[model samples]
Target chain A: MTDKIPVTVLTGYLGAGKTTLLNRILSEPHGKKYAVIVNEFGEIGIDNELIVGADEEVFEMNNGCICCTVRGDLIRIIDGLMRRKGKFDAIIVETTGLADPAPVAQTFFVDEAVGRRTRLDAVVAVADAKWLKDRLKDAPEAKNQIAFADVILVNKTDLVTPEELREIEMRVRAINPYARLHRTQRCSVPLGDVLARNAFDLERILDLEPAFLGSDGGAHHPDHGRDGAHAHHHDGMAHYHDEEIQSVSLRTEEPLDPDKFFPWVQDLVAKDGPSILRCKGILAFQGDPQRFVFQGIHMILDGDHQRPWREDEKRESRIVFIGRNLPEENIRRGFAACQV
Target chain B: MTDADTASLTERTRAIVPGGLVAAVHFLKDTAAFVLGEAALLLAAPNREQRRVAIHDGGILAAACDGQRLVTGGDDGKVMATDAGADSTIVAVDPKRRWIDQVAIGSGAVAWSAGRQVFVKTAKSEERTTDVPSSAGGLAFAPKGFRLAIAHYNGATLWFPNAAAAPERLEWKGSHLAVTFSPDGKFLVTAMQEPMLHGWRLADAKHMRMAGYAAKVRSLDWTADGDWLATGGSNQLILWPFAGKDGPLGKMPRMLAPAQGLAVEVACHPRQPVVAVGFADGLVLLVRLDDGAEIVARRPGAAPVSALAWNATGSLLAFGTEDGEAGIVDLG
Candidate 1:
């Protein structure tokens, strides 16, 4: 896979200054050539000469919900890009506001050719903080764009008060507690946070969620009802939060049986994969020093045993599920029953 | 979803209309044909105008035909064969499930490469396996029928299965993806990881670097006379002349049939000076190499045309696109 190119999917809500961020990524001092793919050639024209206009054709799943669906044009476009293997260093795909990252991420895993030639680096999301919570309540697509992100850039922070900013960050954490969050203005964040993150890599998954497997071993409860408290808080203010999409973190200080863990996770994802946007857990398998790191998007799970736990690191198992209306009790019981 | 847009297709073939992504098309025999891709190897009869799906397992990625039998390698790890009759049988399977990336059928033997191992099965069904230095990037059977050349990282090996000697390796600096010996067996060329192609004279093993392509040379074809090797890389067909012993050395290549889009696939007629090129913009053109004259055979579409092939008699032309839309353009 080293020979394969890395593709970074740039997604954001409409008017979140994605074009400016794309322009910054293109004209940066870094001498890397990127093939920029945009949803459409809109008024904010991508100044890159090697821009490809992508069609937002989302293929729905058999379950009939608007979950993970493959983007046909992306496969075609990426395959065409593979023909010129050495032409560019990386690929940056800009999805439309209505786009779901599930299908975009699935294209890299589902298509044999694309999966073999290119790896999805990370999904960087830019959200307009001033109006993001509003969009979250009114638009399911906005929530998807947030939950599906590997990195969340809460842009337009200047437009909101510090308390409002904190509320947005809290809301973002509520939907996706596992993703890397950043606050910026004019969509300006350190370029390193957006590129070559290897966020989905086995080694980096732990790094992405440093608190995965309770690395800090902090006193955390399974039912962290932080979102419910902030779900609709009005200090004579107009900040209302939606609770349909919230994050549920399950942490246990126990070794788990692989046989029980895999199937339970599989069954849970199978029955609720559409509802579960992202699920990741670093498990301490019975008698195995190495941590088993796995993450899933819908039903597609990619995992393997990673490096042995550091001498000083705790061996607790932490599982994070970010989705809509998840069954926390059954999930907690199921995970707890797997303890050896 | 509206559809994958198998592109606004207007069929010109006898009857078969392949839908999905057409990975390749090859003339199976005199009247039968193999339209590769979502169909795997759909057996097509021109006279009877019947299309039957032959290999039904998975999408076919690599395929080659040897006049009578067609061999295909699929992502399913199965090496299969089918003749004009309709039945397709799996010749072999790699238990490890690696993609059988390259397949070649020539001179009574079928050879396929899965990862670093190359397997050859004779018409009598005798099979032999040889491990190359690395995963085989490309495979081609020598016209003389005694040797098979497997291109890999750092070099191309000319494997003489019957001989006791070690396979001759023409060492190069980079990874070689596509390997082929000239029709006369005097020269062997490889498409490298770089956009250039490196070739060597089989007699002396002299280096001949064919460079300056804007992209890696993926599609290659030799004219019927074996004097020119036409390729797809840039917007035009780059033809390297091999008329003299020097073989495209100290000589500029002949360029023909310039198009607005880059050429992705090219096919040379068996008996004529005509070459058909499929472009990235879905345009297909039949060009007369002698005069650089061209006829717009197929117009541009949503998906790029991926494969182009001509019958041995040079009477039938077949083309397939990435969207699984495939048909034949008859040129009597």
Candidate 2:
């Protein structure tokens, strides 16, 4: 897998310092040449060579927010880059602030030509500490980016008060507590933290955010008081913005029945894939010694059993679903049906 | 195309390297094998003995065969020459480290392009650089002459190695890529960005459109007699006949050996009616252009087979999969 070129997807809202991050990577003297791909509207401010501009494709999906739609031409640009194969060591994709991360990430999984040659290193979302509150309320794209990132950068920390910065961090965590949160000014963060994070690997569980994994780690719950509702008032979540997008983490002490869980999840995604931005689960099945871990972008789901459960580890199921107006009640009921 | 053949292929085909994306396959001599991928090069003797070398630290961008030696360019801005005896040398390296995008070797000379300038390194001179109108999209040397063709945004331009005269420009709209001159030097075809092929008759500059491909044509191979141009992009090999004056004009191309994956590489037999096609699924098929009859060579698994080549005598067929699986098949 290391032989495959690693692609770091940089996503953030408008004026969220995406270009600052891009320029940072370009000038880092890391010796790894990068082919920077910028959206037509989101051209990075850097003047270095090998910058490609791709068309922004945010259209209507009929059932979801108009701002939420798939982008195209990512496969074409990367394939074209492959022609100059040995010249560059990696690829960095900078998307328009209005674009959703699902289509961008899906290109790595869905396209055979691109998927075989390169792997998605990680989706790094830059958040504006000063503007995230308003952006999340008005833009579905802003919310989606936060939900899909494996790493989140709270940029422009200098522009916000300490309490305000804390609120923005909690709000981002509310959307995707699984993503590692970093505070920075002018998108300044160590380059090592952003690149080569094999976030998509099935077995390499990067426990960057232990807070989201809960206190019990497994088998029990440290903070399930919200019943997987993710409504954490106990952790300084000051609900300043009434954003429709929320994170719902469901947990159960009972082992699940695969026959019941698979079909239910499949049907739900089929009916509301766009509405369900990102869904991942660490499931324990009755009579099955292996843990079933699955994650998906919209309708595309990929999962496999990792190593066998250790004797000292806990046996339980935890699922986190992040999206707009998720059916929390139905999900809770559906998971209960899988209990053995 | 059949289950029995697929079953037999999986058992007979041996993987040369344990793992890596096999970028290309070239015959160093009659039996010497060269596979380029992930900046690594593997040379295999006719007896199936192998040696692996890291040619470039980056992806090998372009490759061409020169007698028993192969010249390859990479993103590292280095152009290298490798032969069957394992003699490898850095013939040229761009000072600025721009990606060497295209390369061609023939007539005892090698040509490479970085950005908009084309560089030719011959015996008499270290290298001479000539700037093109646009960033070069493709480069090729005339099979029978010293003229080199460079394709770019507007059209294809022809340059002579020893001449100071202005290049002969072949004009058309849109970007041109993967340029190829018919073996007879009577035609030049460029794969266009619009998933079609645009060609010039070279005699009267008549335009020929080879359209209707499902994707952009990437690989093109002229038959031994220059009668057909076997191409990839379609699920099957689309053989466009060029024996006529118009060159595949007002005629339907023959499609053969349809598969589940796209044909990523195509190699026409040097002396026969057969062609070898490598697909995205890592399957290689030897298909007869006459009837589309297929012989499965490699089963679908591994990475895509990015390159395919036959020896001068057309007896040995060599292939490399993206996952570093490579070997030579004795078809003689």
The segments of candidate 1 whose C-alpha lies over 4 angstroms from its true place after superposition are A1-340, B1-16, B32-34
Score candidate 1 by DockQ.
0.02
In terms of docking quality, model 1 is: incorrect
Model 2 alpha-carbon drift over 4 Å, by segment: A1-6, A11-91, A94-112, A115-154, A159-183, A186-340, B1-15
lDDT of 1: 0.76
Q: What is the C-alpha lDDT of each candidate?
A: 0.76, 0.77
Task: Report the first chain's TM-score for all candidates.
Answer: 0.88, 0.86
Instruction: Provide backbone clash counts, one per model.
Output: 5, 7
How well is each residue in B194-218 modelled by candidate 1, as lDDT tens digits? 5678899999999999988876678
Clashing pairs in 2: A85-B59, A86-B58, A86-B59, A86-B75, A87-B75, B21-B322, B22-B322
Per-residue lDDT of model 2, residues A219-328, tens digit only: 12222211233333454344432356666678887989899999989888877676787777788899889888888777777899977887897887888777778787
Alpha-carbon deviation at A39 in model 1, angstroms: 33
* Chain B, candidate 2: TM-score: 0.93
For all predicted structures, in order, the TM-scores are 0.54, 0.61
Name the candidate that leads on TM-score: 2
